[model samples]
Target: MASPLRRHAKLWIPLAFIAAAAVAVWFVAVPAESDGDPDYRDPTLPVAERVADLLDRMTIEEKAGQMTQVAVDAVQGDAVAERGIGSLLNGGSDALHDTPEDWAAMIDGRQEQALDTRLGIPLIYGLDAVHGNASLPGATIFPHNIGLGAAGDPDLTERAAQITAAETRVAGVHWTFSPCLCVVRDSRWGRTYESFGEDPELVSQMATAVTGYQGEDLSADTSVLATAKHYVGDGGTAYGTSETEDYLLDQGVAELSEAELRRLHLAPFEAAVDAGVGSVMVSYSSNDLGDGPIKAHADSYLITDVLKGELGFDGIVLSDWQGVDQISLDYAESVRTAINAGIDMVMVPFEYERFIDTLLDEVEAGHIGTDRIDDAVDRILTKKFELGLFEDPYADTGNADLVGSPEHRAVAREAAAASQVLLQNDGDLLPLTGEESLYIAGSGADALGRQLGGWSGAWQGTVEGVGEGTTVLEGIQEAAPGADVEFSEDASAPVVDRDVGIVVVAEDPYAEGVGDAGAGDHDMRLSGVDAAAVDTVCGAMDCAVIVLSGRPIEIGADRLDAIDALVAAWLPGSEGTGVADPLFGVTPYTGTLPVTWPARVSDEPVNVGDPDYDPLFAYGSGIQT
Candidate 1:
């Protein structure tokens, strides 16, 4: 028999080797940490490893809290630290503003409370900077997406996003709910202006906005996370399906075959993912892919199989505001279904505690698997780590001066010029001499609020003091220094008594869930006053009608014949001078129609590739002098 010492050595040597191998595996999964103590706080480690370590340290409640996003107003009474809320969002319209400096203070206070939490996770704040840093007081409001779509210049589009990102960071926001990638197939859809037009290819090209938002290094001081929103198809909703009271196409059903859906709706998201978009907000609308109307917020095939498994989007999947609540009658089951469907973050804008409790209880009951919870938290925490919020959680207050700077306004002007589409110019009426006595009159002419459209200073973009910006009349006057310029909100004014008449008509400001044209039933006709304004003004003078709207409306042959020129100036935002730049020989007319100009509202759903492809002005139609 062997000696006792020899027998003990053999057993101890194998045990030591096993322990060493396990340690090696841990290091490989995580990045190298200092002193080999498995420290997640080590800055030198890869983000994945740090995320893994932090995730492992979190309890179920902490992890669930990291998945919850609430409105800032709801964060009352120790909620930020006590509840471990992961993020905060100021909706399209929020009651939070004292000054630019106050915005920073508000953000920093919440951040301090977040840092005081058990795990010290920072809260990411999001807002709708759709145009510029739109909701902010001094930030430049770039042209709405429809204008950019008509401009069709990806470079200009990207530049607009870059300015938006820089200005948003200056205002203490970490994310922007912008670059609405919904390919608008129907102009009647209330949210048509939010899209990049009805082409998958165009939307895909514009997805470069992600690069401008996050920059090459996501952790850069000015970088804000880009969101590819209304995932799947919010734009393709079948008309008349909206359940919203007094709302139409905003959240209607998307009725398309899987092939059609894949071809059109999913194209931009693929590009967005390729461009490294950090988040995708699931649509509130439903989709019927040859089966039945199923909400995208809880569709396992849409959220999990297609978005995650097939496309390989590793970013967090966020739900729209109160989106999960609408998925099912039983709120608890809605939480379970959305989680299992691969939503990593819940935008329970209100009632966040209920959302957290339901998710926590669901996980404990085995209704939501532990693996799912881990995956959800993994994505959310990974983004926070990538954002470098751990190393620097406070607002970079120095950037505050960047808001609405002259340089940024110059960029917005460039976009506004590039986005100006010349839809009609009969008798070479454009390239305005500026030498001609010009009469400018219309409801939208002098109204900056109407020019900027919705999501400006307030939710619906009320026309009252819609932030600082030059009005269209002011811009035209600047362009036509040689010509006598006049402005009148009343179209019936004697402005037609001039060498050339310029009439501006506009759709009233509207936003999501409210602007729908009531199912497919559209009155392609312009609003009564505006239409009469066109006839009253154009019928008298050699006038050029500038339709300042989100999308095309009915301008019948009779109406069309009344004007010597027509320009589709889709919601030109704050840079009104950019519109003048192209009109008065300062810049050439280069933009083309993004959407088909229908002859009548009866041509309810006309598009480029439709079977009967007749349009008042074909897609890509633009006339230059």
Candidate 2:
């Protein structure tokens, strides 16, 4: 009934009010300034002045405390306050107690003590949330790096990092050691599956994108801090040279020339630095330049002279666990060398008192300059400030419910679906929708403990009661609700006259160099036990074989020809159920081979850059429905 002009005026008034209200809410929720000037300007303020302003309020002991990171096992809430410890880490050997609430409570208690320190500096918590929020009980676990490489979508990799950040925050963790940028050149290395691929371009693309997952601006977010790790040439190490008593372990020497090193090992790190990665962890392997292992904690040429000066990286440089000790047998000497080398933090997970005492002695003797100590402290403090720890000093236990929540699990399922490579499905045995009963065989089929793979409940992974984990047997039951799943340790176990037979074969559960050592000199052939088992199973029933291993193994042509389908499910973590998504028709398989699949051990260690390049399955090759 009103005139057109009057009607327009009435509509515009409410819309203007709504917009004004929205702006007001944002400003109120996120305050512009707390205790200081909103637009603080101090061009003349050296990094030390800015650091000293914060440190002046801190007690001497509290200042000393900021230099160390203790393992979670060694902590008690009151001890953190008493010693003024600056950081805590859940090493690969540690695990969260059953519930997310329990995990959060543990972190919250430590934070409370850190806040109670004289200066009230917040404590930084770190963990190896390498593939997902892996340490917590119910946290969603993604496929290892190899699977991620096959997807070849940087945007998706970034999204995965975002999801990892969100879920990790919910579990009371504020940092993740992830996005391993190592360009793996040999399949014989134990941690090959942890790398994205053999090419520097692919590794760089995936690793750089992950920096976005933790948020481009760390100053105002609760998202986890990301670390680009095992810096420089860990993946190019020669076979049988790792430091482990076992010949095949992880800490080995890389054999590349200096030029080859820059082309392959250095590119990903350059990209990571450009992406504003918060930290870098040094590798344990020695470089080919005769520098011994680049002992990140004491290599001035690599850490200070190159990374900081040449590359222009400004983030904190942390030592891998126990790496500082490699500098000198005398604890005090080790402390001096590592600090002089420009390491901002020492992850002396144990023996902290010794390190602290030795460092104090070095400072008094003038072996390590106070200025150098102050420089390292400033770097550490600047990072903590940038992370907004001063404003919010405690973990939010209420958010613990988000760990392993349905949303996170869904992401893992999506990753697994995307990562499953259909190497050979000759008779269309996969997507087995109509099979009445699925006869499942092999040690891994019923082994929940082994299915989770390394770094789950232990450093090298465990075989017995390795905490609560899911098995592929359970995954199959969930996938094909009506089909019967039979399990067998001995591959020749009597079949129940099933319509389809599935044999899940695995290398006896081992991690890193231990797994590599067992495969000795062979051209990727299946072990005698595994081969005998596969033959026994196939001879007993009509079946398909699914390999659950760290890398591809060559099976005899006669043995491979007997199978109707073959799938490479490389250590698909707690969400084994996700693997079945491809086996069933729920999701199409799209993953390609991230590493070359050699036909035999004699044809070992070939990478994409090699001239001949003959392989059982070429890099980037996959099958899709």
Candidate 3:
């Protein structure tokens, strides 16, 4: 194979499109305030000026409120208006209302509460629309980041982000906590699927998501705030060091020299900052660069000195869910340490009121200074102003119909097709003609939740009514309209001489620490049932095995020898037809391996640059049809 990066360069968005999509809204215009409204409320004033004016007029309680973010479910009636809460987020829970209209209505009601405040500052709503409007059932679910990394097309990534932004904005969501830029070093990390690849360059290249989400003008109707998350080094943590219960590496420690930390984990964040991302979310992980392991939330050197001072990131430094609480046993110290470390806003979630009162006490007691509070509020208000929330606080229901529209699904289908990496194509077995009598087996063949993996309509991806989309079976049937397509859930039926056999072996849907392989009995291999299905089908006839998983699963040498062909179909989200496209020659296989596929489960940490690197399929190895 030729250089994967150079081959992918041809598919990048045209230079004209890049310019048109540039984040020019990062710099707002400065003009004289209009006569009618206050200077802070006037749309004509510069964002910095408006932020300063608002900061001056805000009471201490209001400023504290601006620095606090709580979950939507925790708030009671009129709590937002009464307490002057700054922002609300849906933290991996079901939507308050199912339809886009209802979602928008709910958020608009909350917006009215914020607008009724003394200063009339609008509230910014956020959600984990990491892959599409994931909280919404009827939104188009694009392939996860690992799949996009295999697809290796930044232009496609940008387009997907654009669609996600448009769909999320229709439901009155002003912000999305997405574009996870972690350079995954250990495959055992549960959030491996959330990263682009194990390489810094690839993760940096995918930062085009920020541009796609923000667009040229953040004030544009389609735009939503993009957060570059798990700041610093969440991906480079050592195994078994996780402080989180029942996890091997989710929130573990990155014990490395400062040079190694900068080289391995800092590049993607630098690229995100250069992309003019709206905010940066601090990681729950800790890092030990010579001194000792210090939580990123409490590490002033990493947060303030490095991310803000060195990278020149003026955007809000937001904390993860209860991220500050992990810094110390004492809640007040945890709050004080995180705030003083330059975290602009805290995701207090349930304990928001306590957070507000505690923050007020800290400021009153001189534990935290007024200047820091003002600075945090300044960043928070600047983003709110940039999002044009002051001018238009309500949701625009014009694009509500586009939430799960066929047009967006078409794009997702194309992405799913492009992301299929053909690793083993012995005897040239793939690109099956439509005329072949096909027998499809295994659970992933018809399972939508299996294809979507995690972070779908819920925190963990689910199979039931995760909106509407094609499954592998449906896609195959559609691709071969006239061909006889038969299916068996486990290949339990006696096999006849079918022209071809395709078995889709899938990992169970999971997210975060629970997905970590080393934490439990998860050996990173195919389940016994899936393995038996593969053997039963391949033993009787020619077969192609599609491993549907978040990361590479150990297939073993015997399983590889049995199958005529193997494809890594890393969690293709809602568009299973994309998986069928390349198999049927509708789209050629161009995706390369994003991570090294280990020959055995024992080769756990194998990577491209390692001295003893030996893999069943090396990184960047993918067969072109």
Candidate 4:
């Protein structure tokens, strides 16, 4: 029983050891990092070499532990260190977060626990950060992916991602679950805004966000690992097939032919891999390969064969939250299936204790192989080495002040302005010149929560405890200083006499399964207060209906005729000024429809190229001037 150092001390290359020590001393001056473990600590060696050295030293327990990720609240005291946990994730809108300093402190506290382990291996912290670090207050809330798709400028998408990376790193987070590569085939899916568009080509183009996230080198302090999510065919799930009670289709069953899956759903992932994305998240949905409904979590052929073998994705493959649990009837079997299926890391979230025990039991029973564990941990460790997380494990708080800086918001505004699609301009009523008074009406007119959509400060995004940002009403006032712009929640205000009326309406914000349209039972239309407000405003004055929604709503032919102009402002986010820019002619309307605008809710899953295509507004349709 000799110490590993004493045993391998004779094998250590003296020159390489000296170079590693030099690297440790050199990198420590800027951001404090690892100074121990000669072979792993040495920055001069190839990442592969460093990873191999570290792997040989880990015990079976530690190796198994490296693949588990749990929520921040799941661990207490020194338990995380005791168990040798490898990663921590702060879920959307965690109440513990108050300020950047507090966030950084939490990360440091966990990291300290992680460092106290036998090998002092550091943990990688992650967040949703899908749109400009949504979990943090004062962080820039960029337009959702559907809007970015409408803008169709990969350069802008990359720039926004770069800013997201910098801001996220400042908050001490090193990984972002973003650039949701789901190519939406159905607009009824609640997460439509999360996708670039219905077209695979469009989704592939926007994978530029991967470049923005990883930058040229992940070793840089500013870069964060980007994730291409819901692998294979999350976006192609057939309507009405969802089993998550009351839900329909989202994360349900995808029955796409292998060719269609590769051509459409899998195309964007290829672009992401080309950009060197550090991770891929397996989809919660099931894909039927002629046998029966098989969850992606248990699909060895897809995860290990298609993604890892065929696509050549060398990065880590992560599981969605609680995804493994749904794989089989028993937790231990589920754990075994998901692991052997090629998921490198399991986002166990709240049940890490159970997950850890299950995995250990599976390994001990020979249900799961040590070779598989080694492979998974190797990929995980390789990324950590590449991220330079071992070199600098602590949060970089220097750019904390840049969370919602003017420069980042400026880019958000530009993105918002470019995403607006003017569907109709019957009387050229838009571009209000400030020469005439205007009236603002509808639910979303002043709702910052609605404009930002889902996954903003919380998972099921809401107005309650929202971050600081401009509402559409505020943007209107700012855009036309000389003109009289008044807002009435229900258009019941005294001054009904106005040159023009702007009615804004939205679907209450939603995220994933909870936002589904159960067999089209969920009406994608402006109803109740929203519809009444639309009528009141259009009745009082020549009106332009500014639709702030994730996808096309059922504003039937009657409603369309009532308004003089129509603009599809798909969840423009915090910068209401971006919407105002196009509405007031500050910037011309350049956005085209990313998905086909349906004429009714019954045309639920309609998109471009459907036979007998009769959309209210076709994909790529937009009015100029």
Over the stretch 1-625, how does candidate 4's per-residue lDDT look in tens digits?
A: 9999888877788867899999988555333324664587788999999888888777777887799898988887786798888988977644357667778899999999999876788999998989888888888888999999999899999998999898888888899998799988887787888999999999999999999988998977679999999887888887763354554577788886778888888889998988889999999999875677899999999889988898899999999998999987888889999999999999998877788888988999999998999999999999998888888988878778888889999999999999999999887887778668888888898899999988888887885427889988898888878878788878788646688988888878887866677533235778588898888888778999988888888897887899899999998878999999988899999998888888876786787888999888888999876
What RMSD does each model have against the real structure? 8.4, 14.9, 15.2, 7.8
Candidate 2 Cα errors over 4 Å, as ranges: 1-52, 56-62, 75-79, 216-222, 241-249, 290-294, 464-470, 482-485, 495-497, 518-530, 540-542
For candidate 2, what is the TM-score?
0.85
- Global lDDT scores for all candidate models: 0.84, 0.73, 0.88, 0.86
Instruction: Supply the TM-score for candidate 1.
Output: 0.92
Write candidate 3's Cα lDDT for 1-625 as tens digits.
8898788777666865666555343223222334577788778888888888878777788899888898998998898988899999988735557887888998999999999976789999998988788778778988999999999999999999999999989888999999999989878777889999998999899999999999999977799999998897999987753355644587788989999899889999999999999999999899999888999999899888999999999999999998888988999999999999999999999988799999999999999999999889999999999999999999998978888899999999999998999998888988888898888899899999889878887787775537778898999888778778889979987789798899999887888877888766455889898999999999888999998888988897987899999999998988888999999999999999988888886677788899978789999999999
Indicate the TM-score of model 4.
0.92
TM per candidate: 0.92, 0.85, 0.93, 0.92
Instruction: Kindly provide the TM-score of model 3 when superposed on the true structure, using C-alpha atoms.
Output: 0.93
Error of 4 at 457 (Å): 1.0
Deviation from native of the Cα of residue 572 in model 4, angstroms: 1.3
lDDT of 2 by residue, 1-625 (tens): 9899887997898899999999998666433333653211232454456566765444445556788888878765477888778888988735766765677788887888888755566788888877666666666667678777876767767777877777676666777778788888877666777888888888998974456546866643437778887777888877663354535336677766778888989889989988888888888776756644455466687788778888888887888888888767777778888888888788988887777777777877888876777667777787777666666656566666566777767776677667778888886767888346767777677775556666665666665525444577787788778787767766666765777777887654555556564444323456666677678777666677877766777777789877777888877766777778788888888888878887775576788768999887788777788
Candidate 3: how many backbone clashes? 0
After TM-score superposition, the amount by which residue 395's alpha carbon in candidate 1 deviates from its true location, in angstroms, is 0.5
Best by lDDT: 3
- Measured with C-alpha atoms, the lDDT of residue 20 in candidate 2 is 100
